[model samples]
Target: MNDSRFTPVDPVDLTARLVRCPSVTPVEGGALTLLTELLEPAGFECTRVDRNGTPNLFARWGRKGANRTFGFNGHTDVVPVGDAAAWTHDPFGGEIAEGYLWGRGATDMKSGVAAFAAAAVDFVRATPPDGAVVLTITGDEEGPSKDGTIALLDWMRTKGEAMSVCLVGEPTCPDRMGEMMKIGRRGSMSVTFQAQGVQGHSAYPHRARNPLHALVRLLDRLASEPLDHGTDHFDASTLAITTIDTGNSATNVIPARAMARVNIRFNDAHSSASIAQSLRDEADRVTAETGVTFELQVDVSGESFLTPPGDFVRLVTGAVTAETGVEPVLSTSGGTSDARFVKDHCPVVEFGLVGRTMHQVDERVSVDQIRQLKSIYSRILADYFA
Candidate 1:
C-alpha cells in the first residue's frame, strides 16, 4: 500500500463504526460526520447538504475547472433493522465474528462507502490526476427518496458540475465480489386500474354487474403474455399485479367497484409513456369486451437506460479481472436505485461487493472483499485520469 490512509478500512472496524450510527432512513445519525472526517483531511472539499432534514454530501478533489470528472455515488442511509431478537448477532453490533463484519449496512452498503473513500484517498495520494473526482453521498435512499440523490443531482446540475462517467457503489454482484456489474437498469412503472359496476343482491344475479369479474379478466389480459423476449443487456420486461382490493365483506352482495395495482419492470425497448399507453389500450379493450366502465392511472417510476461500452467501463472491467481473475458479466437487472436519476446527467453503471446479505438479518462482508474492492476502485481511478 503506497498510501497509509488507503489501506482497506479494517472491514471489521469500519462496519462497527458505521453501524453504531443509527442512520435509519431520513436520519443523519452522525454517519456524514464520520465520512467528512475521513475525507476532508485527505484533500477533499466536502459540502454537506441538509435538505428537508435529509443529509447529503458532495465531496470533490483533483484540479478544479477540469472537463473530465469521475464520480463515485452511494447512499449512507440503511433500511430499518427488523426483529433484533431474530438475529444470532446484534443487528447494530457491527461485530467481526466468523470472519465477517456483521451489521445492518455492512453489505447494502456502508462497506462500499468505506472502501470507496479509502480508494479515493489512495488514488489522490499516489498520483493526483489532472481530472476532477466527486463523491455523491446521500442519506435518504432507503426511504421516500425525495430529499436524497435526486435533490443532490439537481444542485450539481445547477452548479454545472457535469461528469464524464459515474460508478454507483451499489451491491451489484450476487455471490462473489467482482463477478458482475450493472451496465444498465430496467425501467419501472406502476398502474392502478379500477372497474365500476352496479351493485345488487347476489340473489338477483341478472340485475347486478360484478366488477370483480371485469377486474379478473383485465388482469389476465395484462399477465397472459410476456412483455418481451428480453433485451440484449436486460432481462425480459415483467408486469406484476402487486395488489387487488374490493374492501367488501358481505358475501351475499355484489361489489360496486374493484381496484388493482400493477408494477412493470421494463427493458430498454420501451419508455414510461409507451408503457402507459399500452396500459390504456389494454384497459380499454378489456372494458369494451366486458361492457364495464373503468379508470386507469399510471405512475412512470423510471425510464430504462444503458451505459454504452466505453473507456470508463473497460477500465473498471480490466481492474476487476486483474484483481480477482473474475470476468464480470455486465447485466441490467434488479430494482431501481438512485442511478435512475443520475442517468440523465451522464453514463452510469453499478459495481460493488457481493450483495447476498444486504437488508437481511446479520448483514455482513468479509475483510478480504473490502481490500480487493479498494484495489479495484483505485485501479479504475488511475486508468480514467492517468
Candidate 2:
C-alpha cells in the first residue's frame, strides 16, 4: 500500500505531468489516468464518472471507520490557449525557465491540482490521518459546467459519501501566494429587455411611439442609482448594460422594436428574483410614461454566499501565516466560479497561487511558487486533520 512513487516527488514534476494532458474542457486527455496512476497505489480507491460526456474523478484514501472527510475540489480541464503564436513558448511546453513553468493553465489551476496531489501523497506517506481525504476533480469547469461537479455531487449523495468541509484550489490570491482566501462570491445574472413600438416615418412624430426613447429611459433608471451602497461582507452590487440593439435600416425610419441586455454582479442585498422584479417595475414605469409595452427576461446563474470566520477559514489562515508569514484576508469580491456551485453543498473556500496570469496568453506559474503552494496545502491538511 505504500505509494513511494508519488512520495518525495517535486512539485515541478507534478506540474509537468498535469500540463502534459491536453484536457481542455469536457476532454479527458488522460489527466484522470495520470491522477489515478499516481493515487491508486497509495491505498486510495479511484473511480471515474462520465456524466453526459464530461469526465469526473472521485478518489478517497484513509482508514475504514473514518468519520470525518476533507474534500478537495478542482478542475483538470483548462481554458483553450488562444493564439499560440502570441505565446513565447509552446502553450503546453511545461518548460521551466526564468524560475517559472511556461504553459496555459499553469497558474489558472493545473499547478494547484498538482501541488495538492503531491502534498496528499506526502501527507499520507508521513502520517496517515484518522479521516479520509477525497479529491473531486472534474473536466467541465471551464465549459458549460452542466456535467461537472454538479453531477458528481449528485452521484456522491446517492453513494452516501460524507464531505464535511471542502476547499477549492482555484487561483484566489490577487498579488501574492497566501495573501488571500475567497470565503464567498457575488451572484451573477443576465437580463434582456425588449420594447415594442410602431414603425413610422421619422417626420411623423405623432404617428409612431419610439421604443428607443422608452429603452433609454428604462436604462437610465436602472443605471442612475446604485443597487446598494455596500454589504458588510460584500461590496455594492453592480448592473452594466452590455448591449443595446435597434436594427434601423434607414435613418429616416423609426424602428419597431428595441433590445437591450445587462449583466448584474449582485451581492447579498438582492436575489435574482428581486432583480427581475426591479426590471418589471421599471418596465411598468416606462409603459406609464410613454405607453410602450416591453418584455424582460432574467437568467439567474448563481447566488452569493459567505463561509464566515470559522474552523475551515482558521485552518487555512493559520497555515498561510505559518508558511508564508502572510495574514490572508477572507474576501468575497470576485466574478463567479465553480465554487459558487460547491458553496451550496458544503462550507467552501478558495485558496491557491496568485491569479495574475489566469486565462491569459502564455499563462505561467513560478516554480518556486508551486513548491511553496505544495507546502501550504500540506500545512492546511496537517492543521485541519492533525
Candidate 3:
C-alpha cells in the first residue's frame, strides 16, 4: 500500500463513528450530520440537499464549477438488521474484533465513504490540487432511491455544479480486494402482471376462467427464453419470478384475480422498452388462448451502460494496481446501485472493499482492508489531479 507524506484522517475511526449512527434507509440518523461536521473543518463547502424527506450531502473542496472536478459517491443508509438475536456483535456498535470492524454498513459502504473522505481531506491539506474534489453522500440508496443522488444531481444542475468524472464507493469486489472493479452494470427492471377472470366453483372446471393459469404460463414463457448471449463487457440477461399470489383461501372456488411480479436484469443488448414489449406480447398470446384479461405495470430502475475503456478507466485501474499489486478485472456482474443514477451526469465506476458479508447477520469489514482502501483512494486523488 502507498503511504502518503501527510498523515491521513484515521479512516478506521471515521468508519467506526459512522457505523454507530444506525442510519437505516431514508433515515438521517446523524450520519450526514457527522460527515458534514468532519468535512467542513477541512475547508470543504458542505451543503445539505434534502428533498422529499431524503437526506443527502454535497461537499466540495474546491471552487464551484471547477473545470476539472473529481467526484466520489456513496451512501450511509443501511438495510435493517434482521433477527437481532442472531448477531454475535451489536449491529451499530462499530466494534473492532478479530481484525474486522463489526457493524451494519461496515462492508456495504460506510468504510468506503470513510476511506474516500479521509483521502480527500488529507490530499487537499497535504498537496492541494488545481481542480475540485466533490463528495455526494446520500441517505436513500437502500430505499426507493427517489430523492438521493438523483436529487443531488438535479440540484447541481440548477445551481451550476458539476463533476467531470465520478467514482461510486460501493462494494465491487466479490472474493478479494483489488481483484475486480465495475466499469458497467446490468440494467434492472420489474414487471407486475395482474390477470382477471371469472370466479366459479372448482367442481365445474368449464365455468371458471382461471387467471392463475394464464399468469403461470406467461411467467414460464418469459423465464424459458434466453435474453441474450454475453456481450463484450456484459453477461446474458436474466429473468426471475419474484412473487405469485391469488390470495384466495377458498378450497372449492377458482380465484377471479391473480397477480405476479417478475424482475429482470438485462444487458446492453436490450432496453426496458423491448423487454416490456416482449412481456406484453406473451401476455397477449396467453390472453387469446385462455380468455383471461391482463394488465401490466412496469418499473425500469436503470438501463445497462458501459464507460468504454478510456483515460478515466485507465486512471482508476493504474492507481488500484499500484497500490494493491493486482490488476483488477473490469466487470459488470452486480445488482443495481446508485452508479446507475450517477452515470447520467458523469462517467462513473465502482470500487471498494470485498463485499462478501454485506447485509448478513454480522455484516463487517476487515480493518486492514479499510486502511488499504484509503491508500488506494488517496493515490487516485493524487494521480487524478497530477
- Name the candidate that leads on TM-score: 3
Instruction: Please write out the lDDT profile of model 2 over residues 1-386, one tens digit for every residue.
Output: 44555537587887887887888887888888998998898778898878989999988887533687888888889999899999988888788888889888798788988888888878887778889988888999889888999887888878877577888999888988778889999999999999998888999967999999999999999999999988889999999999999987799988899999999999988888888898899799899999889998888778888888888899988998899999998899888778888887788999888989999998888898999988999998888887
Local error of candidate 1 at 348, Å? 0.8
Give one digit per residue, the lDDT tens place, for model 3 in 3-47: 365566999999999999989998899999999998998889999
Q: Candidate 1's error at 19, in angstroms? A: 2.0
RMSD of each: 1.8, 1.9, 2.1
Better of 2 and 3 by TM-score: 3
- What is the lDDT, from 0 to 100, of the residue 48 in candidate 3? 99
The prediction achieving the highest lDDT against the true structure is 3
RMSD of 2: 1.9
Score candidate 1 by lDDT.
0.85
For all candidates, the clash counts are 0, 0, 0
The C-alpha TM-scores of every prediction are 0.96, 0.96, 0.96
What's the lDDT for all of these models? 0.85, 0.87, 0.93
How high a TM-score does candidate 3 get? 0.96
